[model samples]
Target chain A: MLIEMLIDLTLACGVVLLSCLSLSAQRVFTAIVLYVSLGLLTTMIWARLNAWDVAIAEAAIGAGLTGALLLVAWRRLCDETAAQPEA
Target chain B: MFTKLEFRKREANRRELPPFAVYALGFVVIVLSVALMFSVVVSGKAAPKLAGLAAEKLEASGVENPVTAVLLNFRSYDTLLEIAVLLIVAIAVLPARSSNAAGVAHFCSADKQDVLNPVLAALLRWLVPLAILVGGYLLWTGAYSPGGAFQAGAVIAGAGVALSLAGRHEFLWHTTAARIVINLGLFVFIAVALSNALLTGTTLQYPVDYAGMLILVVEIAATVSIAAILLLLFTELKAMVDAPREGRQ
Candidate 1:
């Protein structure tokens, strides 16, 4: 019962942190960081829920691959912005 | 003294900060405090029952590995759609122009030279094959082990990246072989699911005797597709790396 409560508390805190980060982050890189952290925390939630398969997929595809993709996109966007001149 | 004071005032006037910083800091502090409180106050004894339930139900699904059962049996349809989504994203995001054809000649001519030290090459010679063997073993044993399609695919892709970096294999940004491999997993997954539905009167339900074979086949296909996708992404990044050089030339 205590373990359950802890898991629930962790999940609730994770969700709140993720939401706050998502709303408060000013930069795209920071947003991606928050998103990936959220993914990791959600994976923990899934593990707590006894869904190890979903947890693994969440960690791998959700956090890892998606983070990579976002970073790549961020780099491309920054490059494009840097190449542009103020009129 | 008046001039110095004026200069100091000017410096202070120029040192402006964003107005949102204070609010953002306050928010962060609040969140951290909440997280601390939860961690301190919450206990850790409520998850075992769920784990036990999962163990019981998953074993009854005829899969020895609970994760495998969850991925391939309990939620097979989701896996099917996930592969489809991956294929769609790969197609939509990858550029139409063939980077392979454009850069192949340059890549081949640049350096046939071995860039690595002989000692590293010898070590990699042993390590690469061993890694491949382990990856294959992981895929084969996924039915009863912690290993699975994604983990094995990542391992194989890591080897591919290493080999390409070592100059053993040319980086092909877009190739027919790659395209085919990328789509083959989704194709096989859909076809198998459809066939199962048609023959068995239920979706994704293989014959009892053929369950292992079907799982293995799907895993192999997923592994290939995943490896192809990752390799392609890396090649695209490499193309970006060479873009500046090409511009200079």
Candidate 2:
């Protein structure tokens, strides 16, 4: 029971901290990276909740595919003359 | 009098936060969220849900996997509508002048094959088939496992997407073949619906003995279509990205 509680606490704190960092980060890329981590953490939470189907979908589509799409879009935006290529 | 350095340090120490009103708003949000969470945790019931009902009725659904039976048999209408919605959304948000990028299909010049091409090509040559294999297994196993058409489709689409991003103009990405492939899922799904209605005398109802095989067939077609559709979208985006470079030259 104590171990389960510790695991849950660690995951919960990680999620909350990652989310807050993603939201408050000044650099857009940093936020995007943080968001990907947050998605992954949520996937872990889904597994912990015993929703295997939700966990699979979240990991594959939410984190993997969506993060790739977001990064691709970000790269495209950077290529555009107007957008600043933030580090 | 305070030194100039002390004055600068004092100014640096002062950090601005959102007003008290914002914290008040945060307090409200926190309270509401906590209350909602409490209700969800407290409202747990010991009664069985539809899992028992579905399990009891599973044999009739013609699939060993309860999840698959629920998705492709008992609640097929939901899946049908979901795929239909996906198709419509794909069409509705299609890129303008999509064919303008058709020239990209032939952009694979010998000079362009850099150090990355051989490496990427080697990897893709190895991986795309693996992806297809995995997707096929997932579709086949849907009759007995957690894998299903949607998951399989996503896996296949992931391979197609990786290839599409490689920026190789050799692939028939924006061609008529691509369009047809993209529509294959809708065509097969509708064919099943129509055939079942005409032959079985009911809509979306499969013959008991052939239900598993028929669903598998639909899943395979959906996987192909999904892969093609995702590739099409990615190709369009790549074209947009490539446009400026072409214009500059």
Candidate 3:
């Protein structure tokens, strides 16, 4: 009982830290990485809560897919900017 | 009078709430929310048991797994509409890529990535097949286990994304054959449901002996279509990021 609570508490703290860091990070790329971390922490939270169904969805779609999409979009956007001549 | 005017100007320059005050207010809100969450967690009433009800009807529903019975038999209509809703969302978020246009750019993308190319290719060489295997296993296990069509489909979509990242992108959902795959679930569902209705009097009411086989068939189609639709959604966004201004068809 105590161990479970401790784990949940740690997950909650990690989630909070990552989420705040995601918002406060200077670079968009760094912020996105933090957001992915936050999603992962949230996935852990869902698993801790014993909602396996939700946990899976959160892990796959939330962290995995979202993180990949964000990184790809960021890279593409950077490429577009690089291709354009500076005004 | 000069001292008073100077004090007023200083007051005007000051923020309505100082940074310290803002932080304190945010801290308070966070604490309150945390307390609320704790209270809810501590006092949360356990959800009433539906397993018994599900168990009682499981035999008639024609599935051994209670969850599968609940989703595919007892509440199959919801699953049907859920897939339709997914298709609609995919359509809405999808960029204006033609059936043939999105395929041209990825042809050379693998060659451009000098260092990552070999690694990604080597990894996907094994990973994609493994993903397919896992997805199929999950689907097949749904009859008496926890895995199901949606889970299987998501796994397959993950594999497709990996393949895309490796620059072996198929844009499978963009091709004519792919659209049919995307709609296969919905088409099969309607056909099964209508046939059931015609045979029986009620919609989605499968025959007692045939319910299990029919549900499995629908599940397979749903799994394939769902994966295709999700991959399409993933690839459509990718297409937007890569080829924004070109190939609108």
Top DockQ prediction, candidate number: 3
How does each model score on lDDT?
0.70, 0.73, 0.77
lDDT of 2 at B20: 78
TM-score between candidate 1 and the true structure:
0.63
Most lDDT-accurate candidate? 3
* Tens-digit lDDT string for candidate 1 (B1-249): 111211122235436645587578789999999998798678644567755776877645556887777777768888888778877767755655656455344322324564777887897798778867766877777788667887676666656656665655665435556677889888888888888999899989777667777888888998888766765665565456446546856
Pairs of residues at least 3 apart in sequence or in different chains that clash in candidate 2: none
Arrange candidates by TM-score, highest first: which order? 2, 3, 1
In what order do the candidates fall by lDDT, top score first?
3, 2, 1
Give DockQ for candidates 1 onward, in order: 0.10, 0.29, 0.30
TM-score of chain A considered alone, across all candidate predictions: 0.88, 0.88, 0.88
Shift of residue A21 alpha carbon in model 1, Å: 15
Of the pair 1 and 2, which is ahead by lDDT? 2
In candidate 1, what are the lDDT values of residues A1-87, reduced to their tens digit? 999898799798987889788767878789889998998898888888876656765776677666765675566556545565433
Winner on DockQ (1 vs 2):
2
Q: Each candidate's interface RMSD, rounded to one decimal?
A: 7.3, 6.5, 7.3
Candidate 1 regions exceeding 4 Å error are: A1-87, B1-18, B21-54, B99-117
Model 3 stretches astray by more than 4 angstroms? A79-87, B1-51, B93-116, B172-174, B244-249
Clashing pairs in 3: B98-B249
Candidate 3, position A33, lDDT? 92
lDDT of 2 by residue, A1-87 (tens): 999999999999999999999988866678789999999999999889987666766776778777777676666665653433323
